[model samples]
Target: MHLYLVRHPRPIVAANTCYGSTDLEVTAEELALAHASLLPVLPKKAVLFSSPLRRCRELSASLAETLGCQAPTYDERLAEMHFGDWEMRSWDDIPRASVNAWSNDMVAYQPGGGESVLQVAQRVRAFRDELSGLNIEHAIVICHAGIIRLLAACEHGLSIPEMALYAAQKPHKIRYGELLVVDC
Candidate 1:
């Protein structure tokens, strides 16, 4: 299977804010830019999947129309890690001790009382397994940075717990609207 993992376009949110699973939308200009840039590079006949979040949904829907593929299958498992109470709060505002606790136990600790790293890895692993079962030639997944990282880890044959730790420890450097291709 060939997987095209695309991070959603830049969302309309303040810098340094914690916004996992917050359902933010992208600007019209950003969306247009993303679509135009991606259309030329993406395969014409790939299965489309996207996070249910507005940012990803908008981009995926546009791409599907342009590519003449079916509308993207909205998947909750593709959504970013739920940040719970930290949804829109600035990272600086979160307590240091709490952040420290999460760093110390990234796999188990639920930062912001949200889903743990292990929990996210489990769902992403399930999604990957299902995709493998389909045996598709190509698939395009419009999602967030965290999901992209976790999926990359999964592709590297990491165990779920190892995936959690890898994602938690690795720095996220994927830019908005970036596409990473992985063949499995």
Candidate 2:
């Protein structure tokens, strides 16, 4: 099945910084944007799922209602990376030493109270297993960029650097997770 892994729209935060697992809600304007733009074109056969976070749930709930399906099943395993101490901090504010540390060991390094990339990947793999046994064929998993990046890494065995690059890519477009099927 061709899964439509939809990402949540932007939050009302000030700048574009890492807000992993943070509880930020989308503004009314952004919500309207999703309804006007993505809602009409959403796949009919898609069953919705969201990370437990409010941002993802907001997207998933609207899509599910539009599709006339049941409310989404949320998975904490699918939530964004636990930013811990850096939950709401700006990237520029984080000391360069810490940034360099994360740069070097994205998979292994954990910030104070936060999780590592590899740790999140393991959870993504677990979520993949859970998804495999679910009732739906095509799933629309609305989640954050960090979890999405780790999902890509878990499926393809991408290195830390590659995952980092993936996260830095253009947002909104689906960064592929696992290939649900191979044509060959």
Candidate 3:
């Protein structure tokens, strides 16, 4: 299967804010720019999936229309990691101790009392398995950077622990609205 993982356009949030699972929406211009940029490159027909978050949902809906594909199946599994108490908090404000603890145990530590890296990886793996069963030639997933990284890790056959660590420490080079293609 070919997976085209697309990170959503930037959300309307303050810089350096931790907005995992916050359900923020993108600006009209941002959404338009993303749709216009992606429309020409995307396949006209393929299964489409997207995070239920507004940031992704809006773009997915627009893309689905232009691509002549069915509306995206909004999958919770594609949502960004839940940050719990840390949602909307500025990154600089999170205590050093909590950050250190998460760094010490990236796989198991539930940062901000939310889901652990392992937890997110597990759900992503489940989604991947379910998608694989369909045996589709092409599929597009509109999601966040974290989900994209985990999906890539799954494609590489990484162990669960390895996936957690990789997700926690890997440099996130994917820009907002960028498309990453992975063949699995």
Error of 1 at 84 (Å): 1.4
Candidates' RMSD to native: 0.7, 4.4, 0.8
Higher-scoring candidate on lDDT, 1 or 2: 1
- How far in Å is the alpha carbon of 88 misplaced in model 1? 0.3
Name the regions of candidate 2 deviating beyond 4 angstroms: 154-184
Clashes of 2: 0
List the global CA lDDT of all models: 0.94, 0.68, 0.92
> Model 3 misses residue 7 by how many Å?
0.2
Q: What TM-score would candidate 2 get against the native?
A: 0.81
Candidate 3 segments whose C-alpha is farther than 4 A from its true place = none
How does residue 40 of candidate 3 score in lDDT? 79
Clash pairs, model 2 backbone: none
The global Cα lDDT (0 to 1) of model 1 is 0.94
Residues 7-79 of candidate 1: C-alpha lDDT, one tens digit per residue: 9999999999999989898999999999988999999979999999999999999999999899899999999
Best by lDDT: 1
